[model samples]
Target: MDSNDVRRQWEARSGEYSPEYYAYYGPNDTSDALRCIFEQFLEPNASVLELGCSSGRHLSHLSVHGFENLAGIEVNPDAFDVMAETYPDLAAEGEFYLDAIEDVVTDFDDGEFDAVYSVETLQHLHPDAEWVFDELARITSDLLVTVENEGDVDRDGSTEPDVNYVNDDFPLYYRDWNTIFTDRGLVEVDAREGQRDTIRTFRTAQ
Candidate 1:
């Protein structure tokens, strides 16, 4: 699917998503493993950009922890609206662009952010869309991180029964990090496997 199709799919399910969607990663409510890992790499004032930052939950967490320069890009207008309305302070402090990751790179300069991270976001892109990786790397200076389920499960339509919300007509594209990023000149620095997904960190090869 193209960018417009991806937008339509997400826009259709935006209203169904809620703050509770991030219950698994919430700072005080659940496991601090993810937060602890982020703290190790993200400096206090790091300029961080979150691709596909739905409802800004991670951005809010970073804000609470004193990461001053936070920004995000979301394709769904409904989700962006909810984030802007729910976290006005963070919305004001940072930039939240309503645009697709594939097209947002033209809006920023090279190495504009200290780090660019996405949690369970890249997997949603079409399997052949490797341009997304190059664009993200272009804007990131120091680090790139992705948290996703890596496997051969390719299914399209509503999400599985485990999710609290309904993400309809969405295509799942699980990518091989070793081939995608490494082939593009990024070296994997750290990788932590979880029960459901894997979190991988990368930097431009020296």
Candidate 2:
């Protein structure tokens, strides 16, 4: 599907995989892991941005852990409503952009954020907008991380088609997070594999 079509579909999603739906899940292991990474590598005031922060669930974890500067890009407008209702503290404190990541991220200046991260978000980026990968690298001054279900069909996910459709709808693009960012001028500093996600952290090479 076209990138615009993909954005529209995600923007309209509700009931399941929607803002409220994901908000219901709250903070899980992924959330804990992300918090640990931040606490260890960054100061509490480090500027952080989440690529697709549905209802601000993960960001809420960071907020509660004492990270003050936070922002998020989410396509679903209802996400802000749900976030305002659920994570009121985050909603009040966080700078949120209610638009697709592709659109909002471009306006950011180079090295605008101290740290940038995404949770299962980049995989959904349509190939047409894959250039946003470079933009992601460009905007983060200190650190960049990706926690994603990087592959489904195999260990390296090398054999699967470039684009995998989920439940006959939406697109998930398989990518090597380490290779992608490293090629974009970041250095892969840490990597770990979970049952569902591959977490990779990169630093702007000194």
Best by TM-score: 2
Segments in model 1 whose C-alpha atoms lie over 4 Å from true places: 1-3, 15-34, 152-168
Candidate 2 segments exceeding 4 Å error? 152-161
In candidate 2, list every pair of residues with a backbone clash.
Answer: none
- Model 2, span 98-127: residue lDDT tens: 999998888999999999999989999887
Model 2 scores a C-alpha lDDT of 0.90
lDDT by residue (1-206, candidate 1, tens digit) is 56567556765653234333542334332124445655887787888888888778778877877778888888766665666677777878888888777777667898898888877778777644556777777887888888877764443532331122114456656567756787777889888887766888888754
Predicted structure with the largest lDDT when compared to the true one: 2
Q: For candidate 1, what is the TM-score?
A: 0.80
Can you give the TM-score per candidate against the true fold? 0.80, 0.95
Per-candidate clash tally: 0, 0
| lDDT values, one for every candidate | 0.70, 0.90
Q: Which residue pairs show collisions in model 1?
A: none
